[model samples]
Target: MTPQWLTSIQTPLASAFYKRCGSKEKAKADERVAVIRDNSQQIVASLRLRRIGGHWLLRALLVDPQRRQQGIALQLLQFVGAQNPEPIWCFPYPHLQSLYHQADYQLVAEAPEPILTAYNVYLNRQPLLLMCCNR
Candidate 1:
């Protein structure tokens, strides 16, 4: 996909993705990874990135809601995964762990982390689950 530029540049794209995923407030956020636009200068999708263990980590990978399942996310992941030969660990949301597992990431151990208020509210109680993929 082609990279995009924006005039409404706001917060960091990674933060916007997490907040969007966490709060489901996509309309209110403008931060993005790579902004793809057509002619009118609108944000189509984001390829947000973050860091882990002192290494650059991919945090959010989103295809404009209308253009999903077309392998955009997979392409983005492949691009990021190839950035370095070092192992990449994705601490995914519970529902998404299976996707990673399908990508050959084995469940290594359960992560025990402090319960954030938002998740704690949804989980009835918070349980930290962890998984890792070997390079």
Candidate 2:
């Protein structure tokens, strides 16, 4: 069964979710956040979309540790595609290629600048996959 669709989340809550992922980065003012919340209204998973180089790049996909392996990440990626008409860029880890692939994201040889530069930096340190979902 498909998971419940995401709704726009406020900035503070978005930052909280990122913190839950052990990242110090907070949601930017220009970035839009989408989230899946539990019955108690606590965010279970979320991702940020920022317009970079005239494209929406997906970032900071975080799922509650207790909620992993439930396809929440795939559902969130699908939800982003359904909500946007433009192509969305994502730099998922190599291991998550299948998950992003199932969400309609295809492997891309190159991504836009700045983000690509960032991707290269991360790739230098660890394996990463650059994919984009065209809607």
lDDT of each: 0.48, 0.77
In model 2, where do residues sit more than 4 Å from their true spots?
1-9, 112-115, 124-127
Cand. 2 TM to true fold? 0.82
Maximum-TM-score candidate:
2
* Model 2 per-residue lDDT tens digits across residues 19-127: 9778786876678788888878888887888887687888888888888998888888888789888888778887888888898888777766866876677678766
Cα deviation at 18, candidate 1, in Å, is 8.4
The candidate that wins on lDDT is 2
- The reply for model 1, stretches above 4 Å from the true place, is 2-44, 102-104, 110-129
Per-residue C-alpha lDDT of model 1 across residues 1-135, encoded as one tens digit per residue = 545433344534434554644534332243324444436644445554433334433344566666666655554555555544765554456776655665555664432232222224434543554445435
Clashing pairs in 2: none
Count backbone overlaps in model 2: 0
